[model samples]
Target: MPLNFAHRGSLTEAPENTLPAFQKAIEHGAKAIELDVQLTKDNHLVVSHDHKFTRFNKNVTGLIKDYTWDEVRQIDVGSAFSEEFAGTNLPTLEDVLDICPHHLFLNIEIKNIPVIYDGIEQRLLDTLSHYNRTENVIVSSFDHVALKNVQNINPDIDLGMLFYYRMLNPWDYAANSGLAIRSLHPNQVYVNQTFVQESKRHGYEVYPFTVNDVNRYAELVDFGVDGVFSNEPGVFGS
Candidate 1:
């Protein structure tokens, strides 16, 4: 059966990338979880989807990189979603690592584009190492340069290439990129049976993003995808 990766930890239920959302995902039978990570001004590794807090915080409208971890944590990232999660704060990478079971798989997507964070790859590796959570974790990014930086720092860490556009031969692109990619995270609309088959043939897993529809999930399973990133975690578990 294909794995069900809770996108931003069952984001449909709680504020994305928060501790509560991750807990909800586990309760909803998600064996894997996908999250976005960014660097704060104080060099803290924060778990957030957007570079700016405007989406989550009404009082604050600035980039995450401009604020320290202290400032970032104070913002109520959950209230926008609902009152029940009013006090929910942005979680650090370490914070998320604390709650995750060793058996749970993690797909950590580095958000480094538009505002690059220097030495983020090394810091991420260090944190994972400190917590002994390197295993069963695949670090992915849309920034190929950041992925390459990760590879140069640690060859053992698995990397996933994330792209939205359709590629004629992604497997070839992966092979040519010179990075040992573990998976291909493409937009669900760009995925097909041939894409899945070819990716598997090249020894790379295919995990399409944000698939919430039940029929689409079944179709992807039929296409032989390794898994899917979904907000509705319960819908994909078979």
Candidate 2:
């Protein structure tokens, strides 16, 4: 059976990237949780889908990079999702790590494409190292350079490359591109039997993202994906 990763911690149930969302994923019996990470002005790693909080909250608007950890912590990231989630503040990367179960895999996607976080790779690795949970995590990014940095610093860590558009023979590209990534996370719309076959042949796993429809998820599973990132992990297995 393919692993079911809750995208942004069951985004359909709770605020994306918030502690409550992650907790909800756990409740739904997700085998893995996929979340985005970005650096604050104080260099603290925070859990959020976008570089700015405006998407999550209208009242709290600003680039996460422009705020320090203290300022970022004060933003109500959950109220916009629902009033029940009011006063739900942003979660620090450490806070999320502290709650994740040992058996669950964590895909930490570095949000570096829009904003360059100079030393984020080192800090992320260091934090994971501190918790002694690097083995349970996969560091992924759209930023190939950031992924390379992760590999250079800690070759043992699993690295995944995330891309939205369709790429011809992506498995081959990842295997031979000298980046040495272990997995490919493509948009679910582009995934098909040929892609899965190529990925399996190349010894790279394929995990597509944001697949919420039950029929589509089943189609991808039938195509032989190693796993899928879904907003509704419960539909797959919970």
Candidate 2, residues 73-110, lDDT tens digits: the string is 88888788899998888898899988998899999999
| Worst-scoring 10-residue span by lDDT in model 1 | 229-238
Would you give me the overall lDDT of model 1? Answer: 0.91
Q: What is the C-alpha lDDT of each candidate?
A: 0.91, 0.87
Give lDDT tens digits, candidate 1, residues 1-238: 7877999997888999999999999887788999999999999999998998888886898799989999988899989999999989999999999999989999999998888999999999999999988889999999999999999999999999998889789899998999999999999997989999999999999999989998999899999998899987666444
List TM-scores for all candidates, in order: 0.97, 0.97
Residue pairs in steric clash, candidate 1? none
Error of 1 at 139 (Å): 0.3
Model 1 off-target regions past 4 Å?
A: 236-238
Task: Provide backbone clash counts, one per model.
Answer: 0, 0
Considering summed lDDT, which 10 consecutive residues are worst modelled in model 2?
229-238
